[model samples]
Target: MLVVAGAMAETSLVAFRGWPSEALEFYEGLTADNSKTYWTAHLTVYETQVREPMTELLAALEPEFGPGKIFRPYRDVRFSKDKSPYKTHLGAWLEAGGYIQLSADGLAAGSGMYQMASDQLDRYRRAVADDRAGRELTTVIEAIEQARIHVQGHGSLKTVPRGYPKDHPRLDLLRHKGLVTWQEWAPAAWLGTAAARNRIVDFLRTSRPLRRWLDENVGPSTVQR
Candidate 1:
C-alpha cells in the first residue's frame, strides 16, 4: 500500500519533470523504505483509494512522458532569498506547471495546494467559461481545476464554517495569490475519491485533441505549446 501511494505521488512529480520512467523508479525506491512517513504524511482519503490503481495508470503513461530517475537532493536557490540547505518540500514542474505548496498549519487552514501563474490562470478561466473539452488545452485545464478543487476541499476545509467570512485571511490569500477562485460551472459536491483521480487521468489523456483545438482557435503565436 505504501509503495503504491508513493508511486502515485512520484508519478505526479515525474510527469511534472517530463521523465516518466525515472518517476517509476523514484516510486519504487520510496516503497523500499521501511519508514512510510513520506507516503503516510501526504496521503488523503482520495489518495488512499487510488494509489494502487494509479501505479498501473502511471506505468501506462510512462511512454508519453519519457523516462528518467528521480531528482537528487540539491538546493537551487538562485532566484530566492531563503537559502536553506535543502528544499522544505518536494516539487515538480513541466513547462509552466502551476506551483503547489502544503501549508505548515495543515490542510484545514485552506491554504494548501495553490496553483499560480497569471497567464496560465487566465487561459484556464477562459476554458472553463467556454467548456471546450475536446481541445488539449481545455482538457488539461479542466483536469487540473477538478483535481485541485477536490484535494483542497476534501483534504482541507473539513472544519471551516460554511459561512466563514469571504475576506478572511485564507479566502483573501486564495484570491490575491490566485490560488483558487469560486466557479459557477463546477458542481457543488466534492469529488475527492479514487474515482475522481481516474476521471482526471482520463481527461488528461486527451492531450492530442486539446492541442489540435488550441492550434485552431488560440493560434500558435500565443504561449509556448
Candidate 2:
C-alpha cells in the first residue's frame, strides 16, 4: 500500500512488505512457458506482487544507499537461439555498486565489477601489484570470506598474465578480468518475510570495503563496450 501525506503533488511512499509466493510461482510458470501469452496473462501478478515489492525495497534502501534501478524483464534475443521472451530473474542495482536479484533459487546479492574494459583491467592489475593496495584488498576479502561471502574473478586466465611475476604473492588477484564478492540463498520461508530485506541490507553493508577498494583503485571504465 502507498501512503500519501502532503497534497502538493501525488508523492507517496510504499513500505516493503516482502514478496509473496505468487511472485515465485509466476517465475516458475514463466520458465516453463516463456511465451508472450504467459507473460500477458500474469502481467498483473508481476506488477503488484513482484515489481512493486522490488520498488518498495529499493525505495527503503535509497536514504543511505542512494537510488536503485530495476532491470527490464524482457530479454534480448537478437544473438541467441533460445529466444526466451523474458528473463528468469528480477535484478536491481543499488547506486553503491551493489546488486540484488530474485529468482526461483531465492535472493542473490553482489558487489564490485562483473567485467572490466581493457584500460580498467590494466589499472586493476596494477593496483593488485602494489604491495600496500594488494595486501589491503586481500585483508578485506579475507574478512568477507570469514563472514561466508565468496570473492571471485569473472574470467581468469589459465596462467598469470604476462609482465606480472608468475609466482607473485598476489598472483591470483592479478589474473582476474573482473573482481566481485557474491552470495546466494536458496529458496526458504524467510524469503517471504522482512528478514529478506535485512539480509540484503547486511550483505550490502558488509561488502562496502570491497566496493570502496574497487572504486578507489579500478574506478570506472573509460573505454566503451
* TM-score, per-candidate, Cα-based: 0.27, 0.93
lDDT of each: 0.34, 0.90
Per-residue lDDT of model 2, residues 71-94, tens digit only: 999999999998998999999999
- Which pairs clash inside model 2? none
Residue runs of model 2 more than 4 Å from their true location after superposition: 1-13
Instruction: Please name the candidate that would achieve the greatest lDDT relative to the true structure.
Output: 2
Kindly give the stretch of ten consecutive residues in candidate 2 with the minimal lDDT sum.
1-10
- Report model 2's TM-score to 2 decimal places: 0.93
Point out the worst 10-residue segment of candidate 1 by lDDT: 100-109
> Candidate 1 lDDT, tens digit per residue, 72-134?
333676897855434332332212112211111111111122432445444433432343432
In model 1, the runs with Cα more than 4 Å from the true position are 1-60, 64-72, 92-203, 206-225
lDDT of 2 at 8: 23
